[model samples]
Target: MTLFAVDIGGTKIAAGRVTEQGDLDGPVLTTTTPATQGPEAVLDAVAALVRQLDDRGVTAAGVSSAGVIDSSTGTVLGSTTSISGWAGTPLSHHLSQAIGCPVFALGDGHAFALGEAVYGAARSATSLLVLAVGTGVGGSYVRDRKTLTGSHWAGGHFGHLAVPQAEGLLCDCGKVGHLEAIGSGPGMLRWYYRHGGDPRLLDARELFTTADADVTAAHAIDMGAAAVGTAAGGLVNAFDPDVVVIAGGLSQAGPRWEQPLRASFTRTLIPALSGTPLIISETDAWLVLRGAAFYAQTRKDIA
Candidate 1:
């Protein structure tokens, strides 16, 4: 049966067809998310996008969304300010009703982890931990193709973990000393500016590119990467996953960020966990899409 995949983020809404082999078929369709227009508007926008991609052959659609999602109920339990009025949204039910197809929804972190475990960098591993460094840090732990979602569906929110590097900085969640405050792309840029880096360097992408020549930018990048590595090391000690995968936008920042990150991760691990492999994701949006399709296929009862 033909399946559909959707990934909903604060900045974009993307949809595509998923082949039976759990691969994305053809090009992905995209549009801006109406994040500030409230939950209903956002749901409607997603439904519209799905309609554009729907062929009569579609039996279900799987969604990978940003939030603390309860996949069973397809509901958003909590969300960040990036998407206004996104919390408590009945995503699966709403989208299913709108498109006349079964809809399965899960947190983007969980979906991303599952994607990597099944088809991406960690495909060979029996268990793995994934840290996605982008606008913010997202993470998940997966074993045997299933994610370890916490009781409140908040598992793998590694960005919220407290880290020494973030100690005086304020996190977006109103918490102090959280990983995201120091490891995220924005966090690195903020660090650069706070440390008297050139003001002309705007955004994390620019800051990363400028790191080649500017000492301040390089320091900021290294510090952020180190913070991420430190957190990963601690998590590896706890979960003892066979592999740790790094995904998301910052993973593409090149060796400047990765070398320090590896150094910190290796330094933090205990003797037993010292040999864990750290893999970087090579696929992009298709990874999430493939995971979403897998979710929909496995949860056919909901249909």
Candidate 2:
């Protein structure tokens, strides 16, 4: 059996075909996501891709979107303002009608957890927490091999957890002192700039590179790691997950960030759970896409 998967993000849309064993078939298709265009345009792009696959004998589709999704009805409840006309849209129904196939929709974070639990870092674990921290922080909690979607489908919103920081750090959600305001890549850069660091180091990569040779940049990296570690410690204590998998672009900084991150986590976690293993995924970019494919393969009936 074959399953079609789509991963929709703020900047790109990725589609792939996969088998039951989580192996992708054929080349993955990529296209720039039109943040300025409305939902119609986004749907049109997805439909166009599906049509291309349909000509090649593909049918069912699953979508992993970077927004609050009502999985029960396949609706995108809310999305970043940058992606115009995405709020409260019935994405599943629209896509189903547009592409002439059954559609299953899941949040990107939740899809990532599903992917990891089925085939990646946490495959042997029954309970796990997965964090994908890049432009923003997205989290998912999986218990007994099932994704946890709490009341209003907000169970794994770890990024919204308030952080202990000064009042001026702004979050994408318009809040101050949230985890994303301090630990996310953009947030770290913002904090660096606020602390008199050069604004030329506009992203996490540049900041980490500078930190490798500059004292001030190293200080910024340490601060970011500390904040992330504190947050991870809290998550371990709260969920007592068997495994914590970090997967995202920022995680690629290697030891420059991991040492401090582990140190801070060890300092904050209770002794009992401190020993829980934390693994960083090697294939960060495709984890979400693979997870979406896994979800589709398992739910073929829905597809």
Candidate 3:
């Protein structure tokens, strides 16, 4: 069941051979994505990585990419500008042709969700939501060891959900009041900046370090927590899932982040959904990378 798995991000392209026992088989190969260089260059980088394992006996490849992916067709329907010339690219076909194997492509959020379902926080839960709150917010739903990608391959993108209570924030998608606009890492940083916080504190690491002492910084974090809690409430009502795992960069805020998120989530939930499990997974992208490998090897179409 060893397969070549690649995680393609705006900044880096990571690839490795995945073992049958749910682990990477050897040292991971890493390189810059050359994202702005165009889709052709991105494909070139990936093809080069696949060629790195000539004798690995791998028969399949899986890609976890940052975008709204059409998994079945291996197409990038839409993507952040982080990777220029990426949208509409035939990612799956190009890789499959170059590597001489079936290639499965999945959104990074779904990859993370599936990976967590099989190996991390939601391993014991049949149906769970994996919510990642980072520079951007994305989500995925896993049920019975499979991910629901929806009709358009946009199933797990939950960041654009609107939060009626939140105000005066704009999402990159040009929507005001969306959860991403209010809850993502940059959103929180923006919150702090717009509220007259000291300009010296730039990222979450800095703001969180001064959380106890800086009123604005603390408020920004709490605001992000409240937004997630509110969005989770809506998500649960729609999906009716009992398990939700939160993972991403902001999850590293520790107790300061968890306590508020828990309180708000609890208060927002209806009586029937009380005490539903909300787990925080480790803040690591490797989990999603594993999921990509797992999917490439396990998907019936690919096999």
Candidate 4:
């Protein structure tokens, strides 16, 4: 059965079709998320996207969403402020009502790891982990092709880990010295500003432009990478997974960002786990959407 995969982030909504064999079909359809209009409008937006699909042979639909999701009931337990009024929304119920198909949902992190295992970088690996560092940090670990949602559905929140001991680094989750406070796009930007790296710098792009020569930009990037790498290292020690996938906006910033990440990740991993493949995801909008579809293919609750 073909699966309709929907990826709902704070800024965008993307949809794609996943064939039974796990290949993504056609270009992903895209639109801006109506996050500001409140949760109902966001649900309507997703339903509208599903309505445009060729549903004749579709058997199920899945969602990768930007929140802590209760996967069993397909409800969003909580979300970042980016998605206004999204908390406590029954996602699967609403989508099932709209599409008339088995609807499944999971936090975006798990979907990303599932996508990697089935259709992306980590294909052929029995166990893997994925970290998506973007506006904020999110990730999931998959073993035996099953994504772990955790008892509290907070399994993949690697960004909130206080692995790094940096001072004054506050995460959006209202914590101090979190991975997100240093590893995400905004985190790097916040670091740049806090370190007095020319207050006029607007964002991550501008900071990276001169990172080669600018001490502050270079320092911020390395610090962020170190936090991410350190956190990843800790996870590797804990899970002993075979592969790790790194995706998200900062990953696209090229080696200026990645060199440090790789270096720090290397520094953190133990000897036996050192060879675990570190993959840089081709994490475009399509792949992120495909992650959702990939998860639905195996999620027993929906099947």
Candidate 5:
């Protein structure tokens, strides 16, 4: 089946046509997310973009959004300051109404996992754990090709998992000591700044670029990787996933990040769980779009 897929992020909203064969039918389209203008404006922008891709052949639309989503109801149950007034938005209902098609909605983390499971690196695995470490560390667990969205649809929020390394740091959710406070890209930058890194460096990329020679940068990277690894190891012990896939911006940090994360993960895991493979996602650009399409296709019966 052909379906429309939308990825609504804080920075941009992307859309494209998806095929049942796990690929895009055409070029992906994008627009700036009207996050500051509130939910209605964001929805309008998304609907407009989807309409641009609309053809009689498109059967439905699937949306992957950033928030603690209630997939069953296609609602945003919680959100961060990245998008103002985003929580409590009835995403599926509104988008479906405006786009004149059935819409399925879920959090970005879940979408990433689903996409990987169906078409990316973990396609061969029966159970998978996905960690997307970017603006914040988002994650999801997919078993037997199905995402495990919790009762509140907040499942796989790995960033919020508390870690000793992040103790005393404030998280975006107003909570203290969450993994996002130390394990995310921004979190690593904050660590660099607080621990005597160059004050002029504003981007985490710059810090990571110089980690080979900069002590502070290396330390920050190691700390962040360790925190994430520790958390991931704990999660593995709890769930015993067949594989753990890492995605998002930080995954591109090369060996500086991956090495330490792998070290910490291996150290933290029990002997039985040590064999679990933790790898980076093989797919990019179209990951979420394909997952969104699959979500809509599979969950069409949601009331």
Candidate 6:
């Protein structure tokens, strides 16, 4: 059976037709998510994309989004500044009503972890942690092959962990010294700019590219890697996950960040768990959408 999946991000909305085995059947349709748009607009955008797939006979829909989602009720409890008016919105009910089909809402990080566990690097592991480091850092923990959505469905907000650095770094969540303040792609770039570094000509990709050939860029990459690795190590020690998967745009830095990240993780792992492995995603950017599709397939009652 084919399921329709929608991945909603701060900047874009992507939709595709996915088979039961998580194979995407056609080119994904995408549209820019306007910064000023409210939750209604976001819902409309998702509905339009799902309708396109529905026209092709797709019935079940799964949505992965960057916000606190109440999966039990299909509502978006809250979101970052990128998506306004999402708080208290009944996203699942709206989408289902709009498309005339069952719809499931999932946190983007949880969906990404599910995708990796089912089809990507973490497939063999029963307990895993998946971290996506993009515009912001997001994480999800899977144990016994089940995604853990804590009370209030806000379990994976790991990026809010306090950083060891001084308490001055501001996070978009209106907090200071959070992990995302120094480790996320935007956070890293912002840190560089604040430290008298010029990143005007660089996005996260170019910054990592420059890191390979420039000393200053390398330092920036190292700092970012250290922050990420340190956090991963602490998480590993605390949770003792069998595997940790890194996914998202920053994973594209290749060895520029991966080596340092691994080194930091190794330095931080408890002696007993030093043998644990960290797997970097091969196809980081698309994992969330694939996972959403996987979710749609497994929840057969939704179809």
**What is the alpha-carbon lDDT of model 4 when measured against the actual structure?**
0.83
TM-score of each: 0.97, 0.94, 0.95, 0.94, 0.97, 0.93
Q: List the residue pairs that clash in candidate 6.
A: none
Q: Residue-wise lDDT of candidate 3 within 5-117, one digit each (tens)? A: 88899989988888766697887888899988999999999889868864357878889998888887899998767899899999999989988888899999888888888
TM-score of 4: 0.94
For residues 1-303, what per-residue lDDT tens digits would candidate 5 score against the true structure? Answer: 789999999989999999877789988999999889999999999989988885667878889998888887899998857789999899999999999889999888898889989999889999989998987998888998888988888888899999988999999888999999999988999999999899888888888778878999999999999999999999999999999998888898789899999999999999998899999876486799899899998887454
Clashing pairs in 5: none
**lDDT for each of the candidates?**
0.89, 0.79, 0.84, 0.83, 0.89, 0.80
Off by over 4 Å in 6: 54-57, 165-167, 212-214
lDDT of 2: 0.79
lDDT of 1 by residue, 1-303 (tens): 878999999999989999778877767899899999999988988888877875657888889998899998999999768799899899999898998888999999988888888888779899999999999999799998899999999999999998888999999999899999989999998999999998887799998778779999999988899999999999999999999999999998789899999999999999998999998889576788888888888888445
Which ten contiguous residues of candidate 6 have the minimum total lDDT?
A: 50-59
Worst 10 residues of 1 by lDDT: 294-303
Once fitted onto the true fold, the runs of candidate 5 whose alpha carbons sit more than 4 angstroms away are 301-303
- C-alpha displacement of 7 in model 6, angstroms? 1.0
Worst 10 residues of 3 by lDDT: 294-303
Clashing pairs in 2: none
Clashes of 6: 0
Worst 10 residues of 4 by lDDT: 294-303
Q: Looking at candidate 5, what is the lDDT of residue 266? A: 95
RMSD of 1: 1.2
